[model samples]
Target: MSFYTSLNGLKNAQTDLGVISNNIANAETNGFKKSTVAFSDIIAGSAFTNPKLMLGIGATVEAINQNFAQGPVEQTGAALDLVVNGDGFFTTRSAISGDTLYTRNGAFEVDDNGYILRGGNRLQAFPTDAAGVVSGNTLQSVQVPPTNASGAQFAGVAVGKNGVITASYADGTNVAVGKIALATFLSPGGLRQEGSANWSATGLSGTATYGEPDSGFYGGILSGALERSNVDLSEEMVGLITAQRNFQANAKAIDTATQISQTIINLRT
Candidate 1:
C-alpha cells in the first residue's frame, strides 16, 4: 500500500509538470489559454472497530481545466489582424470536416478567391444591409471581391467596433461585404479545446449564440490588433518548481518504504 501510494504521488507530480510545461511552451502563442491539473484522493479505509485507523490509498487526477481569462491585447497594426475588446469568439468553420469552430485568434486574411480564412477555416459572418445593419440570422462566409478589369484592387478592409466588414476599393468605392459575427457561450470556460487554438462547444459550454460585436452579449472587435496568450511565465515557473519538489518527496517516500520492507525481511531471517 505504501509503494502504491507513493507511486500515485509520483504520477500526479509528473502530470502537474506536464501541464505547467505546456503552458510555458505556449506563452508566445496567440489566443492560447493555460490549463491546470486537478487531483482527487482515494482511501483504503473501511468501516472497522476503530475507523480512525483507516488510511488514504492514493491520489488520482480529477480533471485538467483550461483558464479562459482574456489574454493581453497586442497592437499588430495589420489591417486583417483583430482582437476582441470585450467578450466573444470569432466564429470559423473547418474546411475539412465542415464543423463549426470558435477561436480568439482573429489574425485573418483573404485568400486568392476572396474568401477570408484563418487556420484553413472559413471565417463566418452575417450579411449586412446597405445601411450597415445586420439583416438576417444566417451566417455567411466573409468575402472580399476580386479586382475588376480596371485593376481596382481592394485597397483596405475595415472591421468596425460593431463587426461590419467593409472593403474599400482603390477607386474610392466602399462595399459592405459581410459583418464578422461573434459568439458567446453560457460558460466560456467550459469550451472543449480543439487544437490550433480553436475550441468546440460542449454540453457544459452550451450552444453558442451569435451576434454582432458590441451588441447584446457579444464582444466588440478591435481592428489592427490581436490577443496574446494568457499563459503567465512567472507563474508557470513557480508551478514547475513545486511539481519538482513533490516528485522528489514522493520518490523519497518510495525509498523509505523499500527500506522498511528490507528491515522486516531481515527480522524474519
Candidate 2:
C-alpha cells in the first residue's frame, strides 16, 4: 500500500514537471497563457472509518487551470499587429474546421484578395456603412474594399482603436469597411485552448458576448503591437525545482519500502 502511494506521488510529480516544461517552452510564444496543475488527495477509508485512522492513498490531478492575466505588450510597428489593452479576444473563423474561434494573438495581414487574415483564418467583424456606423449585428469577415469603379485606386487600410476598419483610395476618399468584433465570456479561464493561441468557447465559459472594442467591457485595440506570452521564466524555474525534489523524494520512498519488504522476505526464508 505504501509503495502504491509513493508511485502515485511519482506520477503526480511527473505531471507537474511536464506542465512546467511546457510553460517554459512557450515563454516566447505570442499571446500564450500559462497553466497550473491542480491536485486532490485520495483517502482509502470510507465514511464509517474512524476519522483519525483513515489512510491517505495518494494524490490525484484535479484539473489544469489556465492563467489569463494580461501579458506584456510589445510595439512591432507592423500595421496589422494588434493587442487588446484590457479584456476581450479577437474573434476569427477557422479555415479548416470552419469553427468560430477566439484569440489574443493579433498578428494579422491582408491577403492579396483584400481579406484580413490571421494565419489561414479570417478575422471576423461587423459590417459598417460608408460613414462608419455599424450596419447590424451580423458578423462577417473583415475585408478591404476594392478600388472604386470611378478609377480611384485602392490606397491602403487603417484600423482605429475602436476596431473600426477604413479603406483609403488614391483619390483621398475613405470608406468604412467594417468594425472588428471582440468577444468576452463569463469565465475566460474556462475556455478551451485550441493551440496556436486560439481558444474555443465551452459550456464552462458560457457563450461569447460579442461587441466592438473600446466599448462596454470590451478591450480597446492597440494596432502595431502584440501581446507577449504570460509565462514567467523565473517562476516556472522555481516550480520545476520543487517538482523535481518531489519526484526524488517519492522515488526514495519507493526504494525504502522495497528494502523493508526484502528484509521481511529474508526473515521468512
Q: Count the backbone clashes (under 3 Å) in each candidate.
A: 0, 0
| TM-score of every candidate | 0.94, 0.96
- The lDDT per prediction is 0.88, 0.92
Q: Residue-wise lDDT of candidate 1 within 1-269, one digit each (tens)?
A: 89999999999999999999989999999999999998999976446636777678889999899888899999989878999887889999877899999999989998887988898898999998644777888998887887633679878788888888888889987778888888889987789998889999999999998878887767788899989999989999999999999999999999999999999999999
**Clashes by residue pair, model 1:** none
- Model 2: CA > 4 A from native: none
Any idea what lDDT model 2 has?
0.92
- Give the Cα error of residue 163 in candidate 1, in Å: 0.8
